[model samples]
Target: MAESNCTQVTEFTLTGFTDNPVTQVTLFLMFLLIYLVTVLGNLGMILLIKVSPQLHSPMYYFLGNLAFVDLCSSTVITPKMLVDFISKKGIAYAGCMAQVFIYDLFGMTEGFLLATMAYDRYMAVCHPLLYPLVMSPKCCFQLVTGSYLIGLTNGIGQTIGMSTLSFCSSSVIDLFFCDISPLISLSTSDTTLSHVILRTSACLFGVSSSLVILVSYVAIISAILSISSAEGKRKAFSTCTSHLITLSLFYGTVFFVYLKPSSDSSREDKWAAVLYTVVTPMLNPLIYSLRNKEVKEALRRLTKIK
Candidate 1:
């Protein structure tokens, strides 16, 4: 295509989940409920961690940050998604890029935070005596800060890469939001740079963070097995169950959606995107609180005070 003939796309129309009016209404109600739970659950978790003296520790500290990331991630996508279900709104080019940047920012940060939580678990389970020294307040702060910094870098790289592409082909996004794959597909210009950036960011954040979690859990499991008493083993392993579940839900959907060979967005990809983006945030707080005795106790204390 000649540069002179290329028409710059000013806005992109988002093709949301369904076209049927009944289905759209049904999905809207369901997603609205999910978003409500997500917001309240994540916000409550953060507040609980902040106000409860009992929850003051490296683990809960990391949990609080995770809740904040989940909140931000869900907020960035769900509100727009809810609006789209009822209305046909066109996202401006700048708005689309902003959405991509913000979504990737929190998404990448969540990956690193999950890994950091795994490391915290390993320290607690494997090196109980040294955990306090190793994962001190300063160290914890640095780790959290590092996660955000890396996430910021990824967001900038991805947005810049997407910005470089000229969307002269079409203005309609197949999926509900402005994602990397969908945007690349819409670009008339060469998408090699965008693909490179996408793959590099995925490998850097996805593989590296997953490796950290894997290594940490390996040592943790080994330490748990070393405990002679059955009760001791159960008690030690119980601490990790919630985190393991949360990790499985998060990474499972993420890997399914992004790590696949074909870049073509499918129905499965759209639903899987919902799992990581909408459902996971709402589930995290419940998983942690219901399984954790300390968190339950903290909640009870909070309720009594109220």
Candidate 2:
């Protein structure tokens, strides 16, 4: 905890999942493909939402924000990882810190954005008559802005907390990318405060967002079941199924990655990292677009498909 104990390291080597050249190249190609999909998918989602008049709604607005967050988050980590696989030069200290900040920013953004979307669905399914008034344009903008602001505040707190810890001697970080847990585990200086902040933020961002999503859905499900007709119930549930699946995949992977202690890094943690960082980004747009009939119809109109 003392300032004198802080030794400043200039850079950190990334101990990626494997060391074999063949494996490295393979992983490089794999992640390269994934990054490409993430870019195109999220980009297409935003563009389609923008141009399609039929797609303009509170739900789509939140989806656009989610797409942007997924795009940014994947861009922050995957590209650097692919380059590191080939170059093996590792990231500079400032670069690693920036990666940590940007990645977490978008990660937290996606969590809140998903919660926002859940609330959007709740209003649509449970309060259809008042949905338009309650979730007005101004209200929607505020929700999106609030999600980004929350994400920004959390990123700043984590970065400042990390800056206080002095990394010395060992420059090798144990994850594929610069992450909070691995960085803290590799820190040579005192990290009691850093650890406490990390745990608190994880719970704050992860658990709180999850709780909001769960509560929204509880009300949503209750409203759906009260409908008289089977067709009505099916139609009501259909609107939220995509979001529920997205929430499950994103929050499940996040909890697995961050809820536990940092001292407990394993091969499983690395793979779990892959799920959130790589797989989730790529899957989100797919989940929303492929499952939603409205999105499908919008895409058809966008592409001039019959």
Candidate 3:
């Protein structure tokens, strides 16, 4: 029996959405715009929340953290992807690993953050009078800290698993960045253990966070229906609706990419990946900020101050 000659990949080539130069250029421009918007929007959100005392609450605190995560997450993957679109070689092995670490960190962090946001909304809308008591500063700190801890643990586990895997042969990654799926696919050695670890990690972090969000929303909807006044119900629903939209966009695309069977994954599926990684991050600020009067008013006040 011959030993598999798998060593660390020297360099990895990225096959972004297309090989056509024209299409690549067009896609590059589009993603550039999305990336720019994601950066500015998220930055603006963080600044707005920081400067506006009125926006300082458990809800905005979570929202600010979400914006920060989205910004960093988008930056981790998109900039490299954009450069890869035009560059001769996409990324080196070290660069790829760095991407993997950062991408996983922020992605997992956002998952936990989303769940935290859901819980925050649940407390605020369902138990308005007790919102302060339930989501006290201490409790809010615990929730945010917990979110970071969960994400950090999962990210470290996944990164360690990926680091152990040997990649000797074809170092070409089909997708835009060094995603776990593509990395696993590219490995020359037996990947059963790695796959097991990956699946377990996914279940531990991805599935559990999603389940928590789902339960929170269910309780939230129930609470909303119990309200007697229609206007009151509308007002309550509006607060969390943007969060729901952002959550759906994020989890939907992630589940599609990671959870789906290989048989179902196609070129089109890669496009779907773009929706969450690129499009959704940019849309989050718009969804949360534009729709919320508080954010708008804060922006207005900031503008007037300027």
* Highest lDDT against the true fold, candidate: 1
Model 3 is weakest, by summed lDDT over 10 consecutive residues, at 1-10
Better of 2 and 3 by lDDT: 2
lDDT of each: 0.92, 0.88, 0.85
Better of 1 and 2 by TM-score: 1
lDDT of 3: 0.85
Every model's Cα RMSD, please?
1.4, 1.8, 1.7
The residue-level lDDT of candidate 2 at 193 comes to: 85
TM-score of each: 0.97, 0.95, 0.95
Off by over 4 Å in 1: none
RMSD of 1: 1.4
Poorly placed runs, candidate 3 (over 4 Å): none
Give a tens-digit lDDT track for model 2, residues 58-122. 99999999999999999998988888888875898899889878987888888899999999999
Candidate 3, residues 104-213, lDDT tens digits: the string is: 88888899999988988888887889999998889988988888887777677777777777787677877887888889888877788768878887778888888888
User: The CA-based lDDT of model 1 is what?
Assistant: 0.92
Candidate 3 has a TM-score of: 0.95
